[model samples]
Every structure is written in C-alpha cells, then in structure tokens.
Target: MSASSIPGRLRRMNKTQKLSVAGISAVAAAALSLSLVPGNADAETEPQAISGAPVIFASAAGASQAKTIQSSVIEQHSTAEQLIKASDSAKAKAVSKEKAKKAKAKAHAKEKAKAKKAASKRGKQGASRSESRTPVFSNNLDGWIKESLSIMKAKGIPGTYDGLHRNIIRESSGNPKAINDWDVNAVNGVPSKGLLQIIKPTFDAYHVGGTPHDQYDPVANITASANYAADKYGSIDNVNSAY
Candidate 1:
C-alpha cells in the first residue's frame, strides 16, 4: 500500500465505488501504521496518579513539629513565671523578718527605758527618806549642834543651851581649838582638846553616833561631852568639874 498507487486506483473506479475504496484504504493505512509504530512502554510502566497517604503524613509531621515548638515556648514561660513568684515570696519573707526584728528591738528598748526610770525613782525615794530622818541644815558649828540635838532628842538624852555654854566658857573661853598640853591628860598621852577640854580617850569612849570622830571638831567635842555628862552626872547643867 504505497501512497503513489492509491490515486491511480481511485481514477479507474466510479463515483460511489471510489468513495467505498477510499474509506477501506484509509482504514487499512491506519491498521498498517498501528503495527509499525512503537507502543508506550515507559508510560505504562510509570504510575498514573499519586497516592493521598504521603501528603497526609507530611502534613501531620509538620503539625507535630509546630506543636512541639509551641510547647517548648510555653514551658519556658511557665518556668520563668514560677521563678518570679518564688523570688517574690522570698523577698516578702525577708521583709517580714526584718520588720519583726525591728519591733522586737523597739520593745526591748522600751523595757530597758522603763527599768531605768524605775531605778531612778527608787533612788529618789531613798534620798527622800534619808532627808526626813536627819534634817541637817548647814556644816557650820551651830548647824552641827542643832543637828546633833535632833539626834540626842531621839535618843532621850537631856541637855540645855545655858548649861552647855556655861561649861564651854569655864573650860576653853569659847575657843574651839583650846588645848591643855601641860595638863595631867597630856602627860598621860591623852591630850585635852577642843571647846569642852575633853581628853582623847574620854572623847572616844563617849563619842556620839552622829557627830564627827575628830576630838578637835567643836560640835563633836561638845556632843561627846554632853553625852558623857548625861550618862554620869544625869545632865550637862550639873557638870562643875574638869570633866
């Protein structure tokens, strides 16, 4: 079936018969080329369409990775929040502890101040008691005599101003420093000293409780002499001797 002989064969046939011959020749040419052409071997071997499972698996893996990343971020944020809360709690505890310490210190200081004030008050009360018991005015001779008289009165010793003055004039001429150095008392190593001219041993043996210990002191000498006179002669006014 060459293409050059097909036109010659159609020229010998009638109109209707030529149409049938041309149709059959067209069919025969198509059939001859079908056997001579190569088949689609590579296309038949290759897959026609893709499956849905691989695309679905890829989408799931992407979603899981995104979820993991989001969870990591959320965990980190939660940890940070926990740390902040813990820090704040520690700070609050520390502040409370400091305030408590300050309050305790304040209470301790107040207690100490109260104790000091109470001690001071007790000392003042003691001083008041002492002043009421012994009402001494001045440190002079007259003041000392008056103060000693108060003590003597409390002890029930009897004496008068006239008797004490009369004896002082006769003994020392009112000189508080008068001494009998050439007398028998001086020879016996017990000198007569002060206003009343009393010996050292007699003055000491009859020393008044609230008077000065020195025999040369005027009030001390007068007080000791009066006390001795009260015990022996019963009163200072009855003493007419060198005693």
Candidate 2:
C-alpha cells in the first residue's frame, strides 16, 4: 500500500471501533433503565444491534414526553371529574327545585280541598237553615189549620188538629171570609170573621205574636182564638162546643 493510503485505512478502522463501542454502551443503558423500573427488576431487556450501527438512547426525551402525556392525562381526568361534579350538582339542584314545586302544588291542592270542604259544609248548613225558616204549606183550609197549629205550638198555646178542625167547621165551616153580621159582636161593630170565627176585639186582645193582625187571615184568626181558648179552658182540645 501507499504511505498516504495506510493513514486513511487506519482512520477508518478507528471510526468503526468507536461506533461498535457506542452501540454496546446504548444497549447497556437500556438494560440499566429497565432494571431500574419498579416491577422490572427480573425482566429481560435484550437489544439487537442492526448493521453494526450505534443504538440511539433517547430515554431522557422519552421520559420528558411521557411526563407531558401523563400531565395532560391527569389534567383531562381532573377536568372530567370537575364536569361530572358540576353536572351532579346541577341535577341535584333540579331535583330539589322539582321537589319544592311539587310540595307547593300539594299544599295548594290541600288548601283548595279544605276550602271546598268548608264551603260544602257551609252550603249544607245554609240549606238546613233555609229549610227550617221557610216551610212548605198548601194554600187551603187544612194547610191553614196546620200552620195555625204550628204557630200555637210556638206561642205555648195548646191545640190539636181534630179540635181546631171541629171548631172551625162549627163556627165558619172552614170559611176564611165568613162573617157573623147578625151576632151580638156584629151589632157592637166587632163581627166574628175568618175560620174559628173570632170577633175583632177578642182577636186583638188574644192575638198571638208572630201571626198577622187581620182577623180575616185564617191562620191568624185561628191562632188568636186558640190562644183565648187555651187561656180560658187550658187547651182548645178541651172545648168541644163554641166558647
């Protein structure tokens, strides 16, 4: 070989040896890192050399990248957790609001029911009072007799249907407009009129409260005459003949 070619060949041989050393050093570093891992103390770490090239160990860069990825993952997880918490809080608030709305509606329904019940009760009481105050009576002699009997009972005057009917038939034949124009009371300007045939002066003197003042009113005349009869003979039932 030439003297200059010998130096060039020696330089190439040194460069190849340096590359082989670098490849081996890289494989050793990879194995060391694997051994340093938490649960990989007994794990195998075999590195194959390809075409006698130096194995590049980018462990520091890979670790930096992994740390960045882990940070990003942690941040994503934290963000997800925060979103879940916010959603749960919103759901809870909605549930609470719905419950409050239902409670208010329930209370309103209860109050409405109570008011309806009270109104129904008041209506019933008012109907009962109306029934008591305004009784149904027929526009006839029997109805008048019964009505007078009712008034007599209220005024503490004693009489019966048979007694009042007999007296009314005897005196006026149940005629409310009957007038005793030829009687002593008629001559004295106070004629017996209406059913039970009571004179105006006598009717005025024995007029029961809550009855009409007119002697021609059948119920009023009957009530007043019965009052006089009750005062004289204890009850109209005791008088079978004219008073």
Candidate 3:
C-alpha cells in the first residue's frame, strides 16, 4: 500500500473512535439529568442509588423533628419543675400554718389549765377562811351554865338552867352558832342561816323584837330557839329529838 493512503486510513479510524466516545458521553449526561429531575416517569420507576437522596432527606427531616421534640420536652420538663417547686412551696406553707395552729391551741390549753389551778387554789383558801369563822366554846362548863341559866330566866321561859344547858348541849354541842344542814330537810335552793340553821320562813315567823343583824347574835338566836322549843314541846325537859 501507499504511505499517504495508510495515513488517511488511520485518520478516519481515529475520527470514528472520537464520534463513539462523544455519543457514549452524551448518553451518560442524559441519564444523570433524568435522575436529577423530580418528576420523570422512567427515572421515578428506576431503582434508587445505594446512598439514596430521598432517604437522606427523610433522615434530615427526622433529625429536625427530633430536635423540635427535644425542645418541646425541655420546655415541658421546665414547666413540670416549676409546678413541683410550687407544690413544694404550698406544702411548706401548709405545714407552717398547721404548726402555728397547733402552737396556738397548746397555748390556749395551757392558759385554761393555769386558770383552773388558780381557781382551785382560791377555792381552798375560801374554804379555810370559812372554817376559821366557826366558834369554839371554853372548858368552864359550870360558869357558862350559870350565865346561860340567868339569861333564860330573864327571857321569861319556864325552864331550869340545868335542863336548858342539857338541851343546848344535845342539840349544838354547846355551840351557840351551830347549824344542822342535812340533805333531807335543808332544800338545795334555800340556805340555812346562822345558829340553829334557822330557815328564812321560820326565822321570820319567830323574829319578835330585834334588828335583822340580831338573827346572827348567839344569845338572841339561842333565846329565840329555846322559846320556840318550849312553846312547841311544852318544856325543854319534854323535848326528845335535838334537831
């Protein structure tokens, strides 16, 4: 073959190779473009890549949702913590109020106890003072008998001094201001007054010629009761029961 003919043949082969490469490149570019497009029926139907774009986007969206959830959870946790703190504060306040109430009640109870004790002491003192006011007779029986007999004779009562003394001793243990206040005869509402436990009605009936204060006088009370007994029982010797 000729040298010029051989060179021309080589050039034609090279051109053919270039055209095949260009066609192959164009086909690859078209396939890539189709894959990039959002809506292409053929591309949509094709099997996805190993590192899938849709899967990557879904993962990214999930991550974003997770972040949003985390933010909401943090906010909820904060609100719950605030609520817990408020509840604790309320509990503390309630406990404090209860403690204060208990303390006040205890104080009131203590005051009541103190008042009761003080009242009991005052009652004892009053009882002691009342007991001290009771009369005590002297040991000189004969002298007292003579004086009492003289008084009874002056009162115009038909009685010997010895009988009157015996009667007085039996009735009052020789105590002119003796009082017999028993549950049966002495009604709860009415008070027994002075010597002989003279009820108000009986004393009013018998009070002959004396002041209101004379009812408390030992001599006057004895004379009046003696006179009354003499009138009722005929004589002091005739009387059996003392009261």
lDDT of 2 by residue, 209-242 (tens): 8878999988889899999998999988888886
Q: State in Å the error of residue 57, model 3.
A: 3.0
lDDT of each: 0.80, 0.87, 0.64
Off by over 4 Å in 1: 1-45, 48-76, 99-141, 150-194, 209-216, 233-243
Q: Which candidate is the best by lDDT?
A: 2
In model 3, the clashing pairs are none
- Which ranges in model 2 have alpha carbons more than 4 Å from their true place? 1-80, 83-107, 110-138
Best by TM-score: 2
Runs of candidate 3 with Cα error greater than 4 angstroms are 1-54, 58-68, 136-243
TM-score of model 2 vs. true structure = 0.55
> Mind giving the per-residue lDDT tens digits that candidate 3 earns over 1-243?
988797687567777576665666665676687677876655454543332122223478899999999999999999999999999999999999999999999999999999999999999999999899744444344444554445667666656665666666666665645555674446664444454455555556655454243555555555565567778886666765644
Q: Could you report the Cα RMSD, in angstroms, for every candidate shown?
A: 19.6, 12.5, 18.8
What TM-score goes with each of the models? 0.44, 0.55, 0.38
Kindly state the number of residue pairs that clash in model 3. 0
lDDT of 1 by residue, 73-140 (tens): 99999999999999999999999999999999999999999999999999999999988886655865
Clashing residue pair totals per candidate (backbone < 3 A):
0, 0, 0
